[model samples]
Target: MGIELAWTHGVYVLFVLGIILMMVLRRDTSLISIIGIAFLGLTATGSVIASVGGIFGSFIYAITELLPTILVICIIVAMSHVLTDTGVNETMIRPMTHLIRNATLAYWVIGIVMMVISWFFWPSPAVALIGAVMLPVAIRAGLPAIGVAVSMNLFGHGIALSGDYVIQGAPSLTAKAAGIPVNDVIAASIPLVIVMGVVTTVVAFWYLRKDMKNGMIAPASHNPVTSSVFSSAKVPLAPGIKRTLAALVPILFVLDVVAMFVFDLRGGEATALVGGTALLILIAATMLAHKQKGLEQVTTHLIQGFQFGFKVFGPVIPIAAFFYMGDSGFNTVLGEVLPQGSHGIVNDLGVALAHTIPLSKEVAALTLTAVGVITGLDGSGFSGITLAGSLAQLFATALGSGVATLTALGQIAAIWVGGGTLVPWALIPAAAICGVDPFELARRNLYPVVIGLLVTTIFAMFLL
Candidate 1:
């Protein structure tokens, strides 16, 4: 039986589609998202006053949820500014320039590094670490900044995050929900993740190279946070001092990695570790480089970093607010509006979708992918994965096979779509760091991810 639908669900889905339509047209979605939130509030509460307050409340919820990311980005950007100002950034990347001398090498090398690091610490930290260091090198090696963003996003968030082989967080969630062993989900996902990662990245790279050669891509502008905020007065660090700081930076980060492994830190703990380290580095670098003015310079760099962080995230907040309502933000924003027994708006929709589909290996594969995609629209790749696993179990019972394969397929699709690559707000870290429009990154990823999902789903059918 299908879950009962509420008016809130219909309204939510309508606005989601509208937001997507606006995005597809390359239009700003903030207005649409805000309007949607207001309407959802009004429809649920029947009061203009409450509805208006809900809009602001939803933004709070979004910001609260996104604060860690914002903090990390702001700190990392500040640290990066200091590194650049002190000439330490150039010294740091000088050795890497030899390894990534061309655009092709830059793309793959950075992507591979991102994927590996993400497997250990998750994509959020990996993005900060790699973007801070590799972005300049990649841009200098002739890869556009957006291209660098795409490579890191696809490899880290898309590939390593989806598989989550080392941490096993993604698989553990799906496995528990599917009533199967975590190893089964992991084992099943290895092939699907490989196929999706290889196909999507190859296609994206091909398109990127073709566009570059055709002169269709523009050279990237410098990050406004760094360029505009950095004073014309360069910090006169001795070459030896700059080299020492540069060397120290990597050693500090490497120790953080060792700590992650020893302490079993993951996700927010991992991000906090990285952010705290960046803060110390920012302070140290500023003090070392600025001498007499160091105290004041650190504050200036931090303010600049916060400005850029919020500026880049401004358009994203409203949309994220709207989507967050589809999950945990519902009660927080609108208060007991959804029908009783509802599994959140998005999950209910996924459940309804699964019930409506007929059972066959091909249909089951396709339905799981669709459910995964639908649930992923909430932008928390994880929020609806349990539903995906449950749906996978349901379909597998009906088809008498392929539970692990279907579960893996759903997990992969969910993470690829919402974990980052195709979601504008979800991918902000990469986009903001690389100084590209998040929507454009999402658009660029759309075809490749869609094609990959199609191919991987078909492959899942065969595995069944």
Candidate 2:
């Protein structure tokens, strides 16, 4: 194990610490992140002019990587606004009022429902759909707004996004990186995913329930309509249109999910199905409400949607840019020229750790988990999956451990953190929709997710 930490690797660690500090302090680190990028670029290139250019380039790179997520969110928010305008959002929630009769039931139902939807359509779009429909219902049913946020974050982002069972995108990334069949990683991931999901969500539910009993969590009169974009100009609709659109909207999304499976769609294809459906729904619903004036109002909704998207997109850009540096693929795009043998700071540190650490199955499991968590800091959970897979293979060769289980364990850790549960930037979609602070939401998720990861790592030992 020849572990030589480079100067760039040390700076990367410092920046990561800086990021965590900002999150802990509830401060925005966009400026600090940009500064970090500039400094990294300067150190790597030994050129002031190139380093300055790298700052803008890194930001652009980050935006390009996250464009799909931004677009999906913008389109969904627009669709939701149109639904609200037509009174369809309210009508949709009306039927669910009976099903979620109390706070306890509401919490579980909201989480479970988000998980199911996210499994099919991915959590980025599911956050909007679930938040629009179920959040208000859960609030009305006596769940605290923050508790509702926690439930959705843990289940949708933490569990479903981490596992990605239906889509299997996460597993495929890990599998491909590890040079193994996708099915092996997916099959290996089941127990670990289940253990992590069950443990984290259950712990969260118990904590929330206890908080409710202790009056720490508000049980009633929780404000659900907290986001500005969601509080739009709602027109009183005739019962017929409200009923018709409300019924059709969910069916359309569900059919879209079904079509994804039937046609073997995944990744961008699945995202397009969701986003395209939302856009079409936005058009039809807006036209239904405005009729002759539909042309004007539809423009209004799109403008509002883009505004909301950009608002969220701004803070996200710098954070993502800093993290994207952790992935080797972005080294050339985001920064100045690097020295020979130096690439991604995070991957380099990961390699150093793997080489330096003592060879033992137990130690390797925990080490890989830590590496996955570190790699996931960049906010795109799937980006670090390749590193996890590669490290798993590396450790297996050294320690004779099972590659599949180690890879699976690393995948869970990465996805659970980067996929959105613990990272504030990644938690934006769920946190923004639920009208909670993303950092606070990430803080809330910290304990449950960490505990779940530790337990799941231990469980993976037997399999190995």
Candidate 3:
């Protein structure tokens, strides 16, 4: 049987094209494009009443599906805020100063710390904690602001956020679209994340070396925070009890890894362990800061944490809602009213294209990866994952590749681009926080992240 493209599908295609054009020419948010497309889809498919129903339905569905993930994010971020306000974040980084006496060491240390913390709590919270404290130290150690930003982007956003092992946010989204276990996604993602991280980090280091040699960059000299706040505290003992805690943190995490291997705890179990640890740390930090004021301080930190979480994820909801409409499983919630046995809009499109294009397993993987990178040009990393995940399911069945592998590949590519590498606007926050030019940061990231992604994609094709 031959399939005909519906007017709704045409509206979706045009809406996507318009978004791409806007991204290329104007660098505007894709939200406007999504809204336009969604309304068009509803109008094309049904009467005015149905269209209205679809809008409300989509809102409810989007909120319901996203609430769990968003709440976890908010709580974790809130916990991070509590830790930071209590000076635990500072205490955590202070010992690492000894490990970072110079620019070269500072780059790696900051990158490593950001990656580890981000893996658990996430990049948004990790950035604030790392940038506020270690940035100045890194600058004084002769690392340029741009260097710090690059390190954070590569490790925190690019690597940790892409993997998302702890909270399982990224994997959950991909897994849902692929119709697989979230644990499977996380397990399969490990090798890919390591490959991309190693490749990208090495490239970033080379760039830093070149810039240093050319005298194009130098350490930052002035810091408002240092002169005003942190300078008053007595330098804590190095490699002391605090250092033991720092060292113990990773050791505990490694033990968790071993337990994961031995006991077979999946991503959620692992996240619970990590979140529990964070809460404990928050409690300890609060007590250490002030016994009587601990309650008030923790509350304050939680508030700041929620504020930051909302800031990061607020814009993502509407965008995710529109894309969720493309998935049949989610469409019911989004107010989609399709005939029985009909495939989703995105799935049907992929199927139609696959029939005409003659895709192999390898080609499907590469194509999805490329699509991910293309969608990422809009600079909201999470937005592209749903589409890529939907495509992964279609291509996986069509070409006989595993859905998890394809989904992971797409997730990595999309995040590396939209999260901060290719898109200048997305990197602006990190750039501005580090006091560097956003365009320059984006330019510096392009070669490394692109090369890394290409290599990782090829590796995924062969290995997976």
Candidate 4:
């Protein structure tokens, strides 16, 4: 792995650290990220005009990449608004409310359900399926919106996605890259995944309980846009109608899950299916609740959803634009600026870090973890796993042992960070669905995830 660092790489690293520092300080990094893009453009192209254009180009690239996620969120939120307005949300969650009597039960039940569904259908669609029905119940049971978001995020995105046992997506990628059988990676990952999942979830719950006791966090509240939409006057559906719609919504989602299995749809396709169903639900609920004004009312709900979606995503876009440069976005936004044979800025950094480290079981395990975390900084968890897999192979070759363990370690770290519970943009689905700030969700996840990674890495060293 010979990577020639360019001036642009240094600039990118500087800005990445700056953004991270800002996040650590709880300050917004939008301006810093925008400026970083400008600097990168200027360094790569050496033209004021092109650099200015690159900033916009980067934004466009970020939006294009994020548009699918944004659209699904908007549609789901719109559907939720109509359900709330028509009183269907209450009826839908009434059954679950009996099961989850308090915050502790709410967190674990939501999390465990999220993990199971995500294992089958993948997290993106599972989030919509579970979050829509569960959030109200969790909140009603005294869990904060942030707590609900964190549970969905850590369980669905971090644990289920990292192992990806049922779908085999994550293990396939890592195993192929490591030149091992997929089963080897999966077998090796089972213990690590359990360790990470158990530790992280437990730590998070402990902190949550402590905070709730001290009154550090509030009970769930609606986001501004949703609050306004909920406040809007609409004709209430009859109790029977609400009960019928409530039953119908879950049946529709369950069918979507079944379709996923029959059709083998995953990721974007699964999300699209859920989003389309949400739109249909939105239209049906609007027509039933506001017969004469249904057309206008549905449009109004959509508008509010869009408003909420964009508001949540606005601060994230610039930061996302900056991180995108770590991968494919660099060349697309600013032309060929990286040195020849470079595997993008982030990948190159991971390779360089791996090369600099000495090879031993402990060093190998730790270095792979570091490489996984570094590569994950791109915020596309899967994007960097190939590099992690390759590095794992390299280290295992030198040590003559522990290839599977190292590969699994790297995969776990990468997904936990980027697939992800740490990255704000990557965790947006849970945050948006629960009506919480993505950054705060990321913050609440940081300590528990970090501690989990630390313990898991040590455990990996033992397995090695």
TM-score of each: 0.97, 0.89, 0.61, 0.97
Candidate 2 residue-wise lDDT, 1-464, digit = tens: 44566566677788889988888788888988888887777777777887788788888887787787778777777877788667787777778889999988987888888899888777776776677667767776877778888988888888887778877888888888888898888888888888998999888888778877888754445443343323534676778988998899878877876797799776677777778988999999888888899999999999988887777678778877877876653565644344456546766676777777787888889988988898787777777788899989887877675888888888888888888888777887777666566677787788788889889888887787
lDDT of each: 0.89, 0.78, 0.67, 0.89
TM-score of 1: 0.97
lDDT of 3 by residue, 242-358 (tens): 445545544554565566557755434554554455556556555555578778866766676567545554554455456556554235754445544446665456445544665
Residues 1-464, candidate 1, lDDT per residue (tens digit)? 78988777899999999998999898999999999999998888889998899999999999999999999998988888888777888788889888889999999999999999999999999998888778888877888888999999999999999999999999999999999999999999999999999999999999999999998888654545334222332677888888899899988888988999999999999989989999999998898887898899999999989998998899899999999988899898778878778978889999998888778898899999998998888888998889889988988898888899999999999999989998788999898888788899999999999999999999888999
**Segments of candidate 3 deviating more than 4 angstroms:** 1-3, 21-34, 49-87, 102-263, 328-330, 335-343, 358-464
Instruction: Return the TM-score for candidate 4, rounded to 2 decimals.
Output: 0.97
Error of 4 at 381 (Å): 0.2
Q: RMSD of candidate 3 to the true fold?
A: 7.3
List the candidates ranked by TM-score, beginning with the highest: 4, 1, 2, 3
